[model samples]
Target chain A: MANTHISYTALPGRSRPYFGVLYLVELVFTFGLLAIGERTRLYLGPDHLLVLRRRFFTETAHRFYFSDIQAITVQRTTNAVTANAVLFLLCALTLGVLGLYPFSGGMILLGDFSFGEELLLILACAGFGLGLALNILLGPACVTELITAVSREPLPCLSRWGTAQRALALLVPRIETAQGVPSPEFLNVQPVLAAYATPAGRLITQPPITHDSGRLHELLFGLYLLMSVSCMIDLTGNWMIKNAFDSLLFMIVLVLSCIALLRQRHSDIPSDIRSLTGFALGFSVLLFYFTRPFTMLHMFWNMPENFDPAILMSSMLNPDDPLYVAYVGTQLAVDLFVGLLGLLGIYRFRRLYRLAQHNAALDTPPPPASNVEEPPAAP
Target chain B: MSTALTAWSGTACPRCGREMERLPSNSVEPRVCPHCKTSFIALLFPAAVQNEFLGRYGEPLREESEAACFYHADKRAETACDRCGRFLCALCAIDTQDKRYCPQCLENGIRSGELPEFQSAYPRHDLLALAVACIPLMLAIPILLIVLPWATDIALGFALGLLLFPAFVTAPASLYLALRFRKTVTHPLGRRAGWFPLTVLLAAGQMVVWAVAIIVFTGSLFSEF
Candidate 1:
């Protein structure tokens, strides 16, 4: 027997200096909060392949035999990562402006400020700006998926295009040789292969498929309901009667929608219930978006025009002053970010609803033979 | 046909159950059955043919003068265990994919769960991340609750400082696990658990909020003095 030795290939290393810098920033600022790095190695045996993943404290290896691989697909997804980053930047910028406005007032009152406060404010702004810049520049991360017949879920393999292509080149021929025939599955996946092969660098347009079993939809629905209820309570307590009434109405709709979704979790959801939930989520997000300027107007209207800037600065610095903190925290900007997230949630739910409808349509047995009077025809 | 049999073991013809012979001078040529006139590709049945012909059965003991089996003293030993070097009779010998193992070694492997065959279908990364994130919080929160009422400012500082354990320990651990499993295609737990990063973020956010609270309150008190 020919002795075919196992050959190991280290995947080409792509250095991400940006990621390193991001980790450094996190380590310095957030005290090493959620920073991780990984290295992967691929091993090609006579009849099997192994992927070795190494992390700081753990090492895991996954093996795939040639016979086990049914199909290999390369997919590119365009996520809303850049848009989310921009939204975050806008939020930070708004907060910085708001924070500096009070400092400007302090400057007017004190004539000359102490160096410590100035230094602190400058550091905060610089940190915020740097974080935002990094987020915007990094763009979205991409994932490569390998679909196997044995497992229903697709395995995600993240790598650069060239390296992934090289891996594919190494794998596909061996799989074909092992099978001793051209695979029909490979022919079926040609479209995806072609999509990747195209030089345009554009993703193939495919409808979004929901594989979450409605969990994310339900969770988001519950969150929106909670937010609406909180908004209503806040407005009512603040004596914003019109806004409170509107929020109350929205909250009632949201509550009903949440209840319907919860019920639909196990059984087939009626189209009307799904539509109602989608509509409620969409309307609530729009309401929040439209009412922002009005909310700001009300906030400015209630502020005391003649207060001393030193007292204002002191109140801002005071942890006990909830109102000032809320103002400095850029609640409006945060609200906008939340609203955008809600909008995304609504889009996902819409897809989920459509998927549910499609599945229900498939599952519903065709109507039995119409119960027309067959006796007349028999006569 | 004789030359082919010396180099390559051909498969039986599907039609007649007779051994097939490779056509002359053609490595990839279809194998032909002399008795049945049936021709077929042998590579399709490669594994079956290989396994059928490759097995070498143990020869029976001749005069009872050979080394005795480690477990069965009366039986003659045929081969030594690859792992532990224990002599085994035919009945006591077991062959794995790569090596021959003694019963004791096999049992040890099974007990320790170090053998590859004993591994679960897929790694439980989600569970690992969850444990990393929650274990410290589980230990620290109760202690904080118990110590808070009677604690002075310094004691409170010490108690709150303990919260940093979960952040520093769990954050890196969870992040490491997530990164390690990022390329995994199949997760037994539906989707990947993204809660680790969020947990890490929450821990960091709590630390920040506490630090700000301490500074503000201390600043206010000092200003009055």
Candidate 2:
């Protein structure tokens, strides 16, 4: 019966006073941008709690009643801490390696200020070390989750301990009271809510679909198309048949990926899109890997050199051209990186497709009751 | 009591959109819709009471019974700013945690970096690693542009040497930093650090090729001499 509405903003723990100072310093020195765009707000009502998320472009609101909530669980997420720890170790190792290198005296001047090479190196090392210590001390960020039987999604209430505890104190008693009420259909309550009330009210009204994948697909496809066109133009100008053939093959794969991605967006069946996307991605990876050497050779041939025509032709044919060898090595490294990214993309798209299908199935209407006669009720 | 069940009297069934009446039972049971066969559980709770803790805004002072607000001279002051001690009316007062502050005081606190809650994002150490790893290599581009067109063995060697520092020192450092800080909690500047390992790897490869080129070019020069 409390009339007061509780409201609080969940700020990240890393935004401490010292860190703020460091952030300002980084901004001034390195031209770094640090803008917090999205904010989540919680409003406790008489019978329900409202979670409002305000983003740059839009605001989303979710309402959860006390009766629908099964349990509130508080747990610490260690993913950030583990990642920071690993980064710290790597930085420390890199510093150790740097220390083994012979020191040379140099000064870098920025406007009126002159920074000694040794001083800058020491500062960088200290900054990294401090970050490592902070990460270890902080351990993991805490998260409070509302576990509801209505849906598979875990409703995150808050991240900070104090706010989460306050929210739990307000919510837990109401949930317990609501659950304690004896009813004939206690076991079937969740299913009934899922079928008729919750999913129909929330999911069907507003499908929670994000266009991030579609945008990413467009970006990657655009870049691939651009690269293919540029390569084709060069091949046409140079009249290289082998290079043209390789470019044509890559263009085909990129086109197919674009088509599959577009089709996947509209397709009802998950497996159809999954297979097409997987094939396109897999084929692109193989194509990039297989055509890497030829691409490198073409690049080497195009490089400006002062040798006679005969010597230039001979040098282009020779794999031992130091510059060419360097170019080839660099190309191979880049290709490997792109191939790994493609593999990751394939995995991610497959998972997204499966989730979409599951959601689609959940949204489907239940079958109509049959005309079969029922037996008379016992009097 | 039956009065508790009356609190849920007017709720419409979710499925049938018809008024549902509470059926008499031993315990609280689902209200069956009379118009349709659909049934629903209704939420029954006491009406919310007014909060007494919040200070109400007072009327404009004609003769100033107490101190006036710093921002609004006509309004009576309810509380003093926690930081600056300036008197604040309910309109100008911003409540954070348990403390109350005037608008200017709050702004000043945020501008001077005294308040942590006002901060948007933190500086990423992982990004620093990537910058350290890649900056020198990137710097090499301009150096190559200036020197490459000149066409001298020594100038190319010098450019390569300059590039090597970032390639060897920054690249490995960046790679290690990227690996360590691979997981992120919040998006600092609306972006996580880019793939530092791949960048470092590419830089390292470039450095090796340049080093080999230098060695071979020098060897060829010595053979000619």
True contacts kept of each: 0.00, 0.00
Q: Write the per-residue lDDT of candidate 2 for residues A225-265, one digit (tens) a residue.
A: 45445443442233347556756766775676666555554
Sliding window of 10 residues with minimal summed lDDT for model 1 chain B? B1-10
Off by over 4 Å in 1: A1-7, A12-50, A57-68, A73-87, A94-139, A142-314, A317-330, A333-373, A376-379, B1-98, B102-225
Docking quality tier of model 1: incorrect
In terms of lDDT, the poorest run of 10 residues in model 2 chain B is B1-10
Error of 1 at A246 (Å): 16
- Can you list the residue pairs that collide in candidate 2? A86-B180, A87-B180, A87-B181, B133-B170
Chain B: TM-scores of all predictions: 0.39, 0.42
Model 1 lDDT per residue over B31-135, tens place = 445543433332221121222233344445566787888988777788899878999887778887787787888778756655546332344464455456555
Error of 1 at B201 (Å): 37
Docking class of predicted structure 2: incorrect
Note the DockQ of each predicted structure: 0.03, 0.02
